[model samples]
Target: MRPSFLSEPVRVRVPATSANLGPGFDTLGLALALYDDVSARVAPAGCHVDVTGQGAGELPTDDGHLVVRAMRATFDLLGGQPTGLAVECVNRIPQARGLGSSSAAIVAGVTLARALVVDGDQRFDDAAVLRLAAELEGHPDNVAPCLLGGFTIAWTAGPQGSDGAGGAGAGGGAGACRLEVAPGVQPTVLVPDERGLTSEARAALPAVVPHADAARNAGRAALLVHALTAAPELLFTATEDRLHQDYRAPGMPATAAVLAGLRAAGVAAVVSGAGPTILALTSIPDEHLPGMGWAAQRLAVDVAGARVDRGRLGHAERDPVAAGRKS
Candidate 1:
């Protein structure tokens, strides 16, 4: 069936995310105050994309664009054919910086698709969008929080003999649970001039690890949840890891050094996502910001993951604003 075109432009805002807060590996993620804004209007002709801010000159401006591709994928999955789209993207998340830029794009695309479709369709809810985004991104950790907000734990439900196992609209067997992040826990990120590819970072890890190291990481991951919740003081030890970070260290020595310095200073710091960007969880008052810097920004936990507005956006809302800017 043919999909109804939007009468007005649809605006979608998606938050940037940091995965593996510490030792949770591919299971934990949190949405940050950073965001990307995308607006779409149905066109009678062909698809076109206009980008500003990050990756303005390099990212594709056609159907090959990630956001547009995601939208098309969603339409294909829903068994509907949508009209051509003219999309404008104001991107803030840095690309390939281990900061969930790609995940944000996927979430934005799916959200935009949902917004453009006619209302009363039962298949376009949050869970359905999340599952689709995860499938497009090939992992649920980053996309879960990007779609649902707060802290999220994502896992694959896998095949079982149950009636719903691996069924359609079941998120391809993925599951996610959102956790509340305490008010005192502040998140700051250090982004370097250099960038790291997620694929290269994954390639650096060994296929196997010592059982002892795995056990330690598992314990710290559990402790991290508590530390982020009740005991902010224990974050220093809670964010410790015996897995991926160390293996990725060689590729991003400068980031590793910054992480070590932050840890030494008693701030809970770890590689943000894959590498290159370091995330520090601290309880220090706003008066005192972390001193050592490549390019650092203090961000808060985003309670709202992604939102869609049905009408035209105001000037301030449509413009490409700096990340974490006070409104």
Candidate 2:
């Protein structure tokens, strides 16, 4: 007989995330209000994935799906036999647009694995989940915010460090740390119709930067954190960067133009994650930003991060009472 926990499905919702936020560069990230919900159950046989909304038709519907792969990987890490899963994904975050779509999927998979197990067992806590997700995602920047919510400062500590675990198969040893973001900072995103791959954007960066530029960016990154927590008015100067953006500009001229125009207008704006999408830190409302025929939305800082709910049906299959409880 199947265990009681396996009698029903487990559903997880993970928020979209924006990384870098300008000068932080693979270190700073924050969660946005946007979300992707995934529901998974132990299937009788083969794995099946059904995707909706963003990337519905293009994404694979079999075991090759990223969410499924993440789930299997987590099971392996737990020293448990992999189970065939029936997974349904309702994706809201745009793909390959600098937003953390893949990170969200990775988080959802890990969360689902933790949620499906018996409660009394050695549970997969936040720290364990973060370590596993970081290993899967290759970095903690996006996954940390997706798991921890709010703002996150992610770093890999040295071998003697007290926190974090080393990357999968990487020779260097280090522990990962994801610190919570202080309050009062909000983001407004300018999403372009075109998409940009993270790999391509990463390849554009030069191996070495001038020492002066490096030093300046370091100062700005420190100031940016202070500005975000206390004096948001200083955001304009604090969000400056000397790395990654200019090199990625040629592939996203329109996005670069919008970013330049916003900064020139005294708004603190920078390329979100890799390219194409621009994240502007502002107290002003979205309706007030100059409409340049692009999609713009004001996003609240997500405080809840990824979560799981049991004994309830999927969003598409929920009853009114269940929906009310969810709300």
Candidate closest to the true structure, highest lDDT:
1
For candidate 2, the lDDT comes to 0.77
Give the number of the best model, judged by TM-score.
1
RMSD, model 1, all Cα superposed?
3.0
209-260 per-residue lDDT for model 1 (tens digits):
9999999999999998888778887888889999899999999888877677
Which residue pairs show collisions in model 1?
Answer: none
Give the runs in model 2 whose Cα sits over 4 Å from its true position.
1-5, 119-123, 161-184, 283-293, 311-327
Q: How far is candidate 2 from the true structure (C-alpha RMSD, Å)?
A: 4.3
Report the CA-based lDDT of candidate 1 relative to the real structure: 0.82
Candidate 2, 191-233: lDDT as tens digits? 8888888888898899999999999999999998788777787
lDDT of 1 at 320: 65
